[model samples]
Target: MRNKIKKWMRKVCFPISVTVCLLMIGMTVKAQESTSVKKGIFAGDIDLSGMSEAEARQAVTDYVEGLKETEITLLASGDTEVAVTAGDLGITWANPELVSEALEVGTRGNVIERYKVLKDLEHDNLVYPIQISFNLQMISDILLEKCVQYDVQAVDATLTRENGEFQVVEGKTGYTLDVETSIDKVNKFLTEEWDHTACTIALDVDVTEPRGKAEELAQVKDVLGTFTTSYASSGSNRSQNVSNGANLINGTLLYPGDEFSAYESVAPFTKANGYYMAGSYMNGKVVDSLGGGICQVSTTLYNAVLLAELEVTERFNHSMIVTYVDPSADAAIAEGSKDFKFVNNLEYPVYIEGSTSNKHITFTIYGKETRASDREVRYESKVLEVNQPPADIIYPDPGQPIGYIVYDSAHVGYKAQLWKVVLEGGKEVSRTQVNSSSYKMVPRSATVGTATADPAAYEEIMAAIGTGSVDHVKNVIAILTAQAQAPVESPEIGDE
Candidate 1:
């Protein structure tokens, strides 16, 4: 019985000892993996086997930094190409946390499971793909700064008048980059398709065709509307300004659906732009200002546009009544505030021919005539209310002699409406209210002299000015003049 028991104990002890040794070996392997990544692991083709977390992170960082110099060629319209590096687009490592994930691999789960994963990685290495990040806006700005200059701009066909005939100047097509779409394409290629090396990308491009042709512009021979205004009363400077503004607007070509801006066509109202100091309206008063008579050019064009049956997009009435056109018939344009704009709504293009002759400025709009031969159109001004100016305004001037005075006549205010009367074969067909105007009443202004060596005369003139009456001021002037001119009486010779 003692021999049998000894044999049984020996068999049990042999198997139990082997199991304890294997458990201790497995714990030793897990402890080694806790300090560093497991063997047979990689981070984007970079082997990180048996490397510490810090070592693996550095390896991945270096890999990403090396990619910064990778060149990307951007091809744009017209055989244009721009070369850039990944650093220029703000590329950086996107997933540093992936390094930690690689370290944790085969470190989790029970001993048998961990052992199986490690064995599998021995034959098939685990790879964690390196992801990259970039600044989208940076890419966009780079493309705009480098690629925009290569884009070609489309040119619209224009018309020119020579020797009383119209000629058409052809236009050219253009090529331009589609920036937004190209940006998306670049991002997709870099993120999903690029192989961490140099590559070429074709930017999205757009084709723009020119407008109008020879046959289409040939229909602009007939005179659609013509208007003439007399600037004969204007001074030489004012007449020069009118003619200068007219020349700036001459030969302007307007295609169908194009809107013409009178102010834009003749702008930068400076001496360098052929403008002079002349009379223009300001706050219901006529003052000498630059680009003064330019309004007359716009007014004449406004009437011609009205007769042409064009669409007026914007129009403003003058602050004071002008002598060139009736009330509500004038169009006023001021710098930075007012503009006279009209659209060419006809089927064919129109040409603007402006000229100055015999102190008169005329604007003729030539286009294909579509109206009936017998049809006639005219505009009339109808007065609504008239406002009489108040008492005269007097200003004392100490610079001139006591009897000297300068005066300007008062302007009566008026409210009027313009009517567009269309007649077919000499019979009125329609009368439409075109526009309404309200002119401000400007009082008569007189600059009277109060300069006198006599204190009594100065005091008398001030008193007259306080009365706000031009007649009273004139009476004071007459009395003072008569006193000065009266013959002095000779003293009796016996008194001396």
Candidate 2:
């Protein structure tokens, strides 16, 4: 019985001893792992010595968050290898592959002399660089690439001499290019140049497509016929000159987009141009000229050009608007500054027909027939305000002493505001305000003073005031006022 009891005790004692040994081994391993833990060199660990406090904190945060590791293998340098291990000198440890990748991506690196040789060794390698989370850099690069894509629409004025005849690109060839291709290309360039603005492209005028020859020709004919019947006058002095001027303009060539100069194309002031030169109305008076009434010719042409719907490159109003044409409708030519210019917008050549008749001057543009929309142009003049002339000076005639009354006085100059209203199809569309030309009132040069009074001086005084010479008027007033209190006509010999 004693031996059996001892055997059972031994078996239990052996099992307990084995269990205690196992527990001791496990505790030893756990303690070792806790004391020598291996972690990767993260961005947060990078020391920023010179940075401001705020910068230092930001740098640390950005570094740790942005850090990444990659796998890499180094050549064995010596028998005593500085193994990649945690808590070892001249060694960095992380996930093996991650550490290698970090190095390849220009991240953590060995600083000691022992590891210097590893950097020069050439070998097949692969790794990933650490990247920041902000996508601004990536977005900027992509957007820059997109900026090159110019998408815009505009008219291209490419003039290539293809043949002897000069043909506009919009016509003859029908080279209508869309903005998506070429204009957009320019737009892209502009987009890069002007980052803050949108792109806009304008087509050349010819590219806007003027009417075809035949269509424009018909409209010109209609306008000429209407103008001849409506506005021509056969006054005694200007008879036959109007219609003849219109006949001269027919079959006159006007090229597309070309400017037509009236003074140059029409007959010179010489009688050879078929118009007689004589004294004609000029600045509210008569002036002698080779083509004294040529203004009527110019005025008629102005109306016709307006009817054709062509662009006016240059135009001017006469010093005083003509009565034949509405105030705004009259165009005056000043050698270089102003001129009546009309572009031949028709696709085909246009001819002008100008002539003068017993009663009126007429102008017509002839061309190949074309179809055009029916449009009528009309003008209405409205008087906005009338300004009376400055009070006329009732001068005591130099001949008559002071206190003499002259019932009749010459009219002075007056000014007014007028508006030119343009109507299309009976609908008021445009209004242009114009200062009505000031008209000088005719001066009365009556002899009220002594019969011996200087007639020439009196006439000169009247002329000065009529011409609106403010200084002269004031001087005359002063002289008259001083004389007013002096004396009555010397009581001729009859003796008062």
Candidate 3:
């Protein structure tokens, strides 16, 4: 009976052993097939196994983000909803390496231990909750940035003088956000299961009382910079235009970041605009046009602004040299083609005072003087080149009597450099080149009609014009005198 039992056991044991070995081999092969962690696994209820690094990261992030939009309600006040977006309240993942940890869970220790971990992960469900906290300052910044629109900042009371007595101006009340309550609303949303989508918070306003009730304007007594230019040689129309333009700019107030436009301030230089026809440059010659001396006013203001160390935005020069200022110092303006502009870069407010006498136009700027008392500013005009004019052009007219000549103009061209010099305590501190101006030369011309009457006199006049007087206008009287003294030949051998 023992022998028979032994024989049956051997046969049954062999087959059973073969089946167990086959099952173990199959399980090992399945485990080894995947280099990464097995699937159907969860780290804190978030699936992370059997995925590439990028895929595992994405999966974990999605799970966290899904819980991020959870709504929080503020119930103390009425129903108001505030959605908590990502990065609000300084939202961030505590353990960002969770995916790496999940990958390593079944990978550490001995083979048996690793296999046991993998088996446990495959069989059981696990949830790992990460620690999330709010950053007080960062969250406050974000919340305040949004709340500023609802809250109005408190403004200080202003003072102004009117009717020779100081008047009281009522101060305005302002509103602000209750920061503590607002932060509470955000915390409740993050802590509780977001069921209600609305949150309510009331804005708290605080009264901002003014220091002084007089409401008197700031005492503006300092003269920041002032400039004056004489226009005594100007015609009646030109003088009117200058005065009109100056009047428009006078008593003008400018706050910070404000810009001044010469053309825009004084618009429509027509008869209706109190501007009359004056002599202005049309092409190359002077003609009767509207707003002739307006440019002079702008030029004067521009120089004053420069002296005050104000910022000049746009400026242009005339085609021909102006008689009022030096070459590059003058600022020319037309309605649409040209303009003069300056910006009020000072911290305090500024006012422009413009007044014109019959002899001069002046631009005085008033603002808080910030510069030192010892500092002085001046400009120097340096001549770089002298451009000689072209040859004289003579036009003969038969209507004129003998030896009659008209001298039109003598314009000398120049190339000059203007430097703005700053001095402190009689020492040169700095120098800035403002502009390089080029003036076009106008050639000297004379209409000598003596040739129609006397041949000898014509030769003498031509001889006088050709001599050493080639560069500039010289000896006009001498040439006329020489022509007068020339002897006329007798009406000789004409067989009449």
TM-score against truth, every candidate = 0.79, 0.37, 0.49
The C-alpha RMSD of each candidate to the native structure, in angstroms, is 5.6, 19.2, 14.1
In model 1, the number of clashes is 0
Q: What is the lDDT of residue 347 in candidate 1?
A: 93
Lowest lDDT 10-residue stretch of candidate 2: 82-91
**Candidate structures ordered by TM-score, highest first:** 1, 3, 2
Q: Please list the residue runs of candidate 2 whose C-alpha ends up more than 4 Å from where it truly belongs after superposition.
A: 1-226, 229-237, 240-244, 281-284, 334-338, 367-374, 382-496
lDDT tens string, model 3, 1-496? 9999999999999999988876785577456545564565565656666777678777767766665564432222122234445445565566767666656666667556666666676678544455455566765675566554555555444433344333334555555556776666555555444332333434333434433233222534468888999999877888999999999888676656889998898888888888988877655456678888888989999888988788899988876778999878888888779899999898766668888986799998876788999999998888898878776666554576445666546567888888999999999999999988887777766665444456665555556555624322235435556667889988768667
lDDT score, candidate 1, position 259: 99
Off by over 4 Å in 3: 1-219, 396-408, 445-496
Model 1 Cα lDDT, one tens digit per residue, 1-496: 9999999999999899988866875876566567688878888899998788899999999999999999989998776889999888888899999988998887788787777787788799988899998788988987899987799999888888989977788998888999999888888888888889998899888989999899899888999899999999999889999999999999988988999999999998899999999988887677889888999999999999999999999999988788888899999999989999999999999999999999999999999999999999999999898999999999989898899988766888999999999999999999999999998888988999988899998899999989988888989999999998999999777754
User: How many clashing residue pairs appear in each of the predictions shown?
Assistant: 0, 52, 11
Q: What tens digits encode model 2's per-residue C-alpha lDDT throughout 116-222?
A: 22232224232223222223333233223332232223333322222322233442312232323433333333223422222232311112334344333333323
lDDT rank, highest first? Answer: 1, 3, 2
Instruction: Measure candidate 2: CA RMSD.
Output: 19.2
Error of 3 at 19 (Å): 71
